[model samples]
Structures are given as structure tokens and as C-alpha cells.
Target: MASVQPKTRTFAGVALIDTPLVNAALQHARAIHDDMSFNHIHRSWVFGALIASKLPNFAAVDLEVHAVSAILHDLAWDYKSTFSTPDKRFEVDGANAAREFLGREAPDWDSRKRQLVWDAIALHTTSSIAKHKEPEVALCHFGIFADFIGPAFPGGIISKAAFSAVIEELPRLDFKEGVKQILCNLCKHKPETTYDSFAREFGIRFVDGYEVPSELERILNALDATAEV
Candidate 1:
């Protein structure tokens, strides 16, 4: 049987893929995430997609994978959500959620597509790794950085009008404080999850009892068998 091509939705020069899978992913995100997070994820997808749409490797990007990954990038931000876990990193939670979502809602996506979504969401925050991974992962990272870093992001490749449109629609009300609040809450409650990641800094600066184990201390006495670097 012939495969159906995904639909492309474009407006004012901005384009996004529209499929049942992507639509379901968006709805799932909207239902679970608060205004700030929902808007931020959408902004990430737009920034990433806009940038990808301009790139030479644009053809290599899996639009649906990128969409779902960005839409569910911060699944752990809500501790009460379906993706929440007591002992996993936030990114891991998001990744697992994305993978599970794909499996349940898009069985035709195949393992590779689901894996791409997993990697994209899993590594969105780990820039050093994500940028070196698949185009979907790298583009997801780029979109996220674009949202946070704005016009100064790396190459400033995305068009100005598109950038403006994304922010205007999302309307970043308290985005900064909203992020701060989540990070600090993790420090206060899931401090172990905050260690050895970007959230560590928030814990150090904001949470009273949060502490990172020294590398040397871990060398002498560690938490697990995993290598520490």
C-alpha cells in the first residue's frame, strides 16, 4: 500500500506538520501542561521547525518526531502528571512519556520514529549531546535555545517575523519566573534529581538543604556503579 504524506500547515511563512499523531501529541501536551509550559513547548517546536525549514538538511528532519518531542519536552515539570516519576530525571520522564505516547497513539510510527522522538525529548536539555545527535534532536535543541536565547541564538537563522509571531501567540507571561519556580521546587523536593544537571545550580542558589556531592567524594563513596565524569 502507498503511504500517505503528512499535511503541511503554513501561515504567514511559518510551516508546521499536521497529522493525527501530531495533533494528538499537541492535545496531550495542552491537556497536561500549564499555560507557561504549553506555550514554551509550542515555541520550541516553532523555533526548531522554522530553523529546520531554512537548513540544508531540512529534508532529513522528521517533522512528526520533532513536533511530538518538543510538545512533550518537559513532562516532569508537573510532578502530578502521568509522566511523573519519583526517581528519574525530568528529561528521562519526558522521553519515556514521548515514547509511550507514540506507542499508544501512533503504532505506525515504527521503532525508529519512536526512538527519534525519545532521543529528541531526552536530550533537548543536554546541548552537548543533542546537537551531535540526529537532525530531529539537534533541531529540537536549537528550537529550545531559540526560545530561551532569542535573537542571539547561535546563527540567528530564523526569520525575524516568524520569531515575533511565535512569541506573540505564546505571550511569554512570567516564562522566566515560571522556569525558576519549577527548578526551585525540584531543588526543594526532588533535589536528587537536580544534581549533576542544569537544575543543580537552581538547587544550590535557591534550595536550602540541596547539596551536590563532590566528584572526589563520589570517587571515594558513590551512589551507584555508573561512571562519573
Candidate 2:
């Protein structure tokens, strides 16, 4: 919640996380997201970059785009947002917000680049889809998953010391609670939008009388109608 200077991270003399544009995006994100979400975004970029560096053709990775995507991926979860609407999924809200910001500030980035950032943010929470997209998308998806669920892939890629250094810089204080609160708010304000999405589970668990029909129920109803026919 407290406004803090955006932290910087560099790789091979290239500014990955602290470029002027990235800092500007961070400023926008920080204005809405609390410290927990802000720190998580920073760590997600670092983690994604680390994974990207391990790829056979690492040169293809675009750090600037990745930084922007990771920074703005959770913007919809912010308590306050000028970009959010009631009917859209939180991911789409974030994707649209980032796209709008880029369109206004970096007109030269071209449509493909903007879509790359949009896909990474919109599909970051979707594992099956995001993993099949571009390397930037896959890295961002896995990086966020790794941060929340622990390293699920080849572990030796990131040394313990390196991991500790990142955590030291951006401490993960109250992140779980902060994320829970965001999910709760989504269910509270937009229960209809959560149906068939990841947030549905959170809604079912947190919101009173919030229920979606189970898959088995649908199948049984289909069978009963078939027997009557």
C-alpha cells in the first residue's frame, strides 16, 4: 500500500526490470495494488527472466515486454481501478489496462508486441493455454506459478543463493493474505463473472450461498432425459 521506489534488476548490462517505461508501469500498478501484489509482480518478473535465461535460445526473450506483462498482470486485483468493469474476468481487465497504457505511452511498440503483453497477463493464470503460447508467455505463467506453488520444474536452474537474494530484496510479507482478500473482493462484487473460472473455487469457499452446478450433476441430468426418451 505504501508507495516505494521501484526496485531494479539487470541482466548482462540490459535493464530488464528497471527501465523508465517499466518504472512508469510500476508506478501505475503501485497506485492501485498494495505492497503484497506489487512485490509479487516484481518477483514474478525475476523468476520469469531466470527461466528464460535457461532456454536454449535465450536471445529470443524480450525482457522489456516480459517486465511490463509481469508488472501489470495483477492490476485487476487492485482494490481501486479506473480500468476494471464488473462483467469482465480480472485477467481481462488487467490485460486491457496494460494494453491501454501501452497504447498511450508506447505507440511505436506495434500491435504484435502489445498483444504479446496482453496475452501474458490475460492468460497468466491459465496454465494449459499460456504454456503453449510464446516463450515470454510461458515464462511469465510458470514464474508466477513457481512463486506461489514453489518450483515445479527443473530445480537446479536457479541456485538457492540467487533465490534468496531476490526474496531478500522483495520480501514476501502478507502476500497470501493480500491475495486472499483480492479473491474475496472479486467474489463479493462480481460473482457471476467467477463462474467456470479459477476464482469460482474461491467464491464457493468464501462467499455465502455461492454455488455452481457440479459436472456430475449435468451428466446425470443428461442420462435421466435419455432414459425417458
Candidate 3:
């Protein structure tokens, strides 16, 4: 579908890679996500981009891919969206859906570039791992982490002015409440998907009757089922 009136909301200056593909991706995210989730992801991108600007290594990084990845990082959080699957972890679901979006809308993007977006979205939650990946992947992770926590990054803090501007544009409206509801919804309906991911704790705490079998038990259960078959 043609992009609607530009919901891609990046900060002024700082050389944004304002392309149709990026705008389309942002627009798509705006359509499917709730206000809090939408604002969070955009904030993540802004935070990450600001960080990347300080590092000389990020010059070679593809900003379009990074923007798209950051914009749609939490796609499957809206579990009711068409992007979500019954059993896939939310990260994988979001990554797959992002690839699908690129395949359909930005056909000119090569497989490697599309996969870069997938890696960024899929690995956004894994700071330990995502940091070791390509620039796009690592930046997405850093951005999400910055927004989730405070913006006091490792090398230095993000500019206070920039942070304020982003927050002013995207006012966080009860972000924790919105996030808890989404996580609880995931646990309530797709408990299997939350079994080993970040949502597991949320499931245990928030979802009634949601069991997390220990690693040993999981292995034993598999082996026993195999023996029975």
C-alpha cells in the first residue's frame, strides 16, 4: 500500500536517510502498534541513531536498514496483528514479518539487506549477542536498551537536548502499563512462545497456570515422549 501522510518521525538534522522504503516501514509500524509501543520504538531509533553518530565506525552502516529494523522491532508484541504466529517467539515473528514487508514493498532491496533488518529486529532484545553482530543489529539493540532503560549509554550519555526533543514529540503514556498488558496477553494466549524468551518471567508472574518446566524436565519430557513413540 502507498504510504499514508508520513508517520516516520525522526529528529531534525543529523542527516536522516529519508527514503520511501524507510517511510513505508515506519508507516506500517504506526498502523499495527499501539501508541505507547509505537512511541517506544521510535524513541529507540532516535536514541540509537544519536549514539551511532558519535562513532566513526557507523559511517558504513546502512541507516535505511537500521531505521526499518528499529521501527518494526516490536511488531509481534501486538500479538493480535497478522504478523504474529501461534508458536514463534515474538522476536522471530517480528523478524519474519519485517522480511515479509521488505519483500512485498521494497523489492529492490537485496536478500542480504533484508536479512540485516531481520537480524536487527530478531536480536534487538539480546544485548550480549546483538552487540557482536553487524552495525545495524547492534545499533538496534543499543537503541532499544537506551529507551527501555535510561539514555546513559556506555561511552557517554545521549545529548540531553536530543533526548528531550524525542520524548517531547513522542510522549510516553504509561509505557510500563502498556508493555505489561502486551506481555501478559502473550503469556495468556501463546504461552509456548514465551517458554524460553524474555517474556518467560512475565508469563510466570502475570499469567495464571503458565508453567515453565526446568531444563532437565524439558529434556526428560522429550526423551520420554520419544521412548513412548
Candidate 4:
């Protein structure tokens, strides 16, 4: 809920909500590693949570569970490998770790809430499961997709050219209308075995014109430059 002054320029025209969950998640994510380099996976989750929080549908969703799940979805990355290529085993491993950590630290959490958090984390990466069965699951799926495919962050794996191509093909892409179609297909159709692989092989390939603000671009460029050095 507290606003931190941006060390860099902020996007003025964007309708973005920096929720407490997002802020907390960002802090937790940054603390997960000493490098301080941005984690696209974590960034994606944070961005997704931010967008979801703004929607009227999110109000009906469980905030505590979703927030915890969103923040900890990739906590294993803190202990394992980077987001460019995540280990499926490590993601499952991270879910266990996240549940343990949350259970210990967040004592007020009830069993149902805890299960929701765990289920959300467990399923965050996989798409084989149906979105309609669970509203939180659907939301988490949508949130992650929106963040990865949306224009909040620059320098994502999906290039501008590819993003354009995907948008152009959206009308023809074989699935139901909207984000659900993409998620369902990615989960059900792809035989790559893991979400990371599916994303690398197919997800990033189809995307195109996500509007990256100049300020975010500058920050991303600076970060990339810093990483290179």
C-alpha cells in the first residue's frame, strides 16, 4: 500500500496498481537473491498480480491465498536456477518449500487458505488442468499470462516481431476466445512435458506487439547492460 519513489521514471499513462501483495512479493523476490537482477518469472507473477488486483473479478477472489501463491510461485528460483530455463522438478520442490515457509511464518492462515495457496503454486506452471474448475487457478493462469505477454515489462523472451505475429494470428489460433484459449491450448496440446519448455518452444514464438513504455525500455536496457557487464 505504501508508495516507493521510483529510482527511475514511472509510466504516467498506464492504469497500474502496485498492490501490497505485489510490493511484498517484489521485496521477497529481490531478497531471494543477492544479484538483484530482475527475475522475469517473478516479474511476470508480480505484474500479473498487479493487473488481477485491479479487475472486479479479483475482489471476489481470495486475496491472501492468491497473494501468497503469486509471491512464492517462483521462490524456488531463489534457491535453484534462473527464470530463462526453470527446472520442473525445482518448481515442484519450490512448492513444498513455499508451503513450509508460509505455514511457519503465516500462522493465521487456515487450512483451506493454505491449500488454495499450495494448489495455486503447484499449478502455476502447468496448464494440463482446466481453468474453469477453479476460479483462483484460472485467475493465476490469466495473471501469469497477462504479465508474460502483456507490455508491463520490456525485453521478455517474446520479441516485438513475434508479438506482432501472434496478435495477427490470434483470430485464427485454435482455441476459445480470450486468454483462456491460449492457456488451455498451451497446457493441453503441448507435449513438451513442462511449462517452461512449452513456453520456450511455442509461447514466446507466437507473441508480438506488447506496448513497452519508453521508461520501462530504458530501465530494461540498463538492466541488460548491467547484466552483460
What is the Cα root-mean-square deviation between model 3 and the actual structure?
4.9
Report the lDDT tens digits of candidate 2 across residue range 1-229: 9856445667432235567788888888788776788889978887777777676644577778888899899888653567778889889999999998998878889888899999999999999999899977877897787677544456666666667777777888987877787887888887766776788888788888887777798689999999999
- In model 4, how large is the Cα lDDT of residue 193? 28
- 1-229 in candidate 4: lDDT tens per residue? 9966423212222223445544665576567643322334444444445545456656666544555666666665332233312334334555676677666666676877767766777677676762553666666666566544564333353345533433342222322233343333433333232334333333344434212235577689899999999
Candidate 2: clashing pairs of residues:
1-35
List candidate 3 segments past 4 Å from native.
1-14, 225-229
Candidate 2: stretches off by over 4 Å: 1-18, 151-153, 214-229
What tens-digit string does per-residue lDDT give for candidate 3 at 139-165? 889888888665566666676676677
- Which of the two, 2 or 4, has more TM-score? 2
Clashing residue pairs in candidate 1 are none
Higher-TM-score candidate among 1 and 3? 1
**What local distance difference test score does each model get?**
0.83, 0.79, 0.83, 0.50
TM-scores, each model vs. reference: 0.91, 0.82, 0.89, 0.49
TM-score preference between candidates 2 and 3, better one: 3
